[model samples]
Target: MGKSTASIDWLHRAPPVSGLERIEAYFSGFGYDPHRHDTYAIGHTLLGVQSFHYRGRKTHSLPGTTMVLHPDEVHDGWAGSDEGFKYRMIYVEPALIQQILGGKPLPFIHNGLSNDPWLYRACQVLVQRLDCGLDPLLEQDALFDLAHALNNAAGVNTSRKTFDYQAAERAREFIHGALTRTITLDEMAEHCGRDRWALSRDFRLLFGTSPYRYLTMRRLDLVRTLLGQGHSLVDAALTAGFTDQSHMTRQFRSTYGLPPSRWVRMLGRT
Candidate 1:
């Protein structure tokens, strides 16, 4: 059957963004070209069915289901229905997930879909359409859990390695505490007492992400909390060391899955 496709108006229709990134919506039959991204694509189908290809398989995903597209995976998006489909997704860098996963291999989505309770609940931990400050260690714990949950869901067997968890954790803390200012691997090395490349590799191994990405997430985390406290988006962006609101917003949606306004509204309701 023939189908019609149109773009989902991100400015008018998308929900408020939380930290980093949140949900991104698009119309069914609206196919994104076969493309690769340098981040993780985490999303759920809302209306009709959404279909895509990954790891050389043709698969279709439905509402109530989660779709995970690993970083750098070649994939294409299209509606699975005649009426088309609508859904929202968050594009998170593998670095973030990696940090959470503790530098394990990126989670594979051969199934390309999941309905596991753990996976569902992980997605929900993030307040929908709202941004807020994290508890002192809540975000750290959440990332750890998300990493473990995704690892288990993907059925990856943990690998044995002579890795130092303490050093990586220390590096993450140093990075997190200084997001409002510039950072460098040299500084991280000095703080963590590891050479730059070795520290970067171990950081990825322990957190499943890089030091730079971890810091960016920290900044995004701050932006959300500041915005919730009645701070102007532009002001929050500047204060967070982001180039501007738009820059922060773009990266924010990619990480948390929605835009800032929608996230703010959701936070307001809570």
Candidate 2:
């Protein structure tokens, strides 16, 4: 018999660039299990049917459509048809959006798919190709455009309480500096010079996630970097400030939808 089309599946991780992680993949059958990550899972379906469960609904993304999965949203991926799916995704941190928007609520596109031309254009720049990465200045400009396009496409949310951008930013900075150490709401309060409860609320409103989740995401980011440099899971876990490898593993699976081993394979690192 000729080669079986059902047996085809592969994933390729683009070379890591500062503040961005990218992947191009194809699957002929099933893909990932139920998983969610702490970054904006933005991409476009290139061929076939890319299907996923998001925000309590099953969404089918067709070719030429954009997929914008929000940070911390529970979602799962797989092929919507036997022919499988092909797509490229960029996982971007909310902090990058905060850098551009400066304390505005993270934009939320209602459904997982969009035909917004501005968004499509902005995203195309980053997801265009894997071999040639964006130059620093160009990448920065792309990020800016993406941020604005997301904001415009997502529209505005009324009835949100007044938020403190400066205070939230201070807390975010503190988290970055102290990722290898224990972080607490009280400590963040002191660092941001705001009441503990108030700061927590502000952080969520401004960054689209709680302080704890933000901290964990940053630690996971470090773990990814360390692992890419050939660090063992245990070593990366310790260096990333997790209590143990198991603890890091649990968080990693919850955030990225796969264990370290599978993640390595997905990146073609294994």
Candidate 3:
């Protein structure tokens, strides 16, 4: 994908894949507000300095380093210098990671950045070809490597806790099937055959986010799809199970750091 000119902010999204969203974008100045989503944001700076406020401190990502923002962590983005910055990012759902890691705690790059060459290589395979869709087998292979690379870079977790992976997986599936309607914790627990609180705790430990966040993110995923298919905001919001347009808009901006209108505009530009 071509980089946007310094005078314009633009974003180019790749063909969609299940459990992943990839995009290449450029910004001359401020990029995003403090926002977060229920997916791991991993990528590298392709040009200039990619700056963000993560974990209560400002961090700058330069070329040749991999940036890994943990799921649901608050962060903001901007250019670190006047020249602007361009980068490609892939958001991977934690459930996909859990599929490979088998219920282990999600990896955390303490500083939200990694200089590990193995990690850089793994990230490159996913982000470098944003314009081209990956083959199913190739993508799965890369994800497996990426998951292990992340775990290795973050070091082994010495503290272990008992978690019911099967129950959490069942609950996740229940959430997916019920995205078009409201779901209660008790209901999900009954379906998954686990205690509500225990299921919630296990879900967080295994998936790196709460069950509610995962459901909301999935709904937002549907909203994006509806919007792409020319649905109006209100229509998309309602169809995605949100209470109203304003409700969806607030959640959209809070999760993505920009309003739905702006996102649509950027998509048009791309």
Candidate 4:
């Protein structure tokens, strides 16, 4: 039998956006191993059948349906049929959602899939534009729509909860500024004028992940930038504040479902 288009796997990633990562990919067989990250994975299957295991059950995403995987959810991906599958995805930080929602709990789509037009359209606006970066104001408008659409899709109440949004934002800003050095909850708490334990709890409630994970992700973001600029892996790791290359590699795979080298290779290809 002749080789089909699905015989080979490839991926293309968009230029980086603050708080967002977008990619389009095709897979013939097994894709990512079981992994989890602290970001909202949202997108659609464009061709064939895209399959994954989420929340202890097998889930299939077909064309026209939106897949909304909440932050920190364990999942893996593969092709559901012989022809394989192609899909586009946008990884959105929950902190961005919290910024717009004023600290409401992160929205969740039932079973990690949705057919809601609101969400489908919102996702399309972000994922369909991989060829170039979005204008800042336009991106903000799109995110506002997406945040509200997700909340509506999840049927979450709009009632305000007891959260320290200012404090959390303060700590998040601090993390962004201090990614090259070690950060402690005590330091963050003091900087934000909140008790350490309370800040930790509120950070989880408002940002959908702990402070430490957020800091680590920021560092990983730096590593990606350095790698893209033609730096060696060891150089990138050290510059990004990792103990060494091995440590950065472990976190990179765990968070992104692929090693840094493979990710760069995929990006390098068409």
Global CA lDDT computed for model 1: 0.66
Better of 3 and 4 by lDDT: 3
| Tens digit of per-residue lDDT, candidate 1, span 82-138 | 756666666665556755555566677666788877886676554244334445376
Cα-based lDDT at residue 209, candidate 3: 88
Worst 10-residue lDDT window, candidate 2: 1-10
lDDT tens per residue, model 2, 1-270: 122233356677777776688888887766766777668989999988988888888899998778999887888777787678899999887878988987678899888899999999999999987888678898899999999999998988776778788898899889889988887899889878999999998887777688899889889988988887889999999999999999999999888766787676656522
Best by TM-score: 3
Candidate 3 lDDT by residue in tens digits, 160-247: 9998999999999999999988889999999989999999999998888899999999999999999888999999999999999999
Global Cα RMSD, each model:
6.8, 3.3, 2.9, 3.0
Ranking by lDDT: 3, 4, 2, 1
Q: What's the lDDT of the predicted structure labeled candidate 2?
A: 0.84
Tens-digit lDDT string for candidate 4 (1-270):
123233367888788787899999987777776788888999989998988899989999999999999888889888888878899999999888988987787887879999899989988889885886788897889899999999999996667568788898899899999988987899999999999999998888777788999888888889988988889999999999999999999999998777888777765665
Candidate 3 regions with alpha-carbon error over 4 angstroms: 1-7
What lDDT does candidate 3 reach at residue 61? 99
* Model 2 misplaced stretches (Cα beyond 4 Å): 1-8
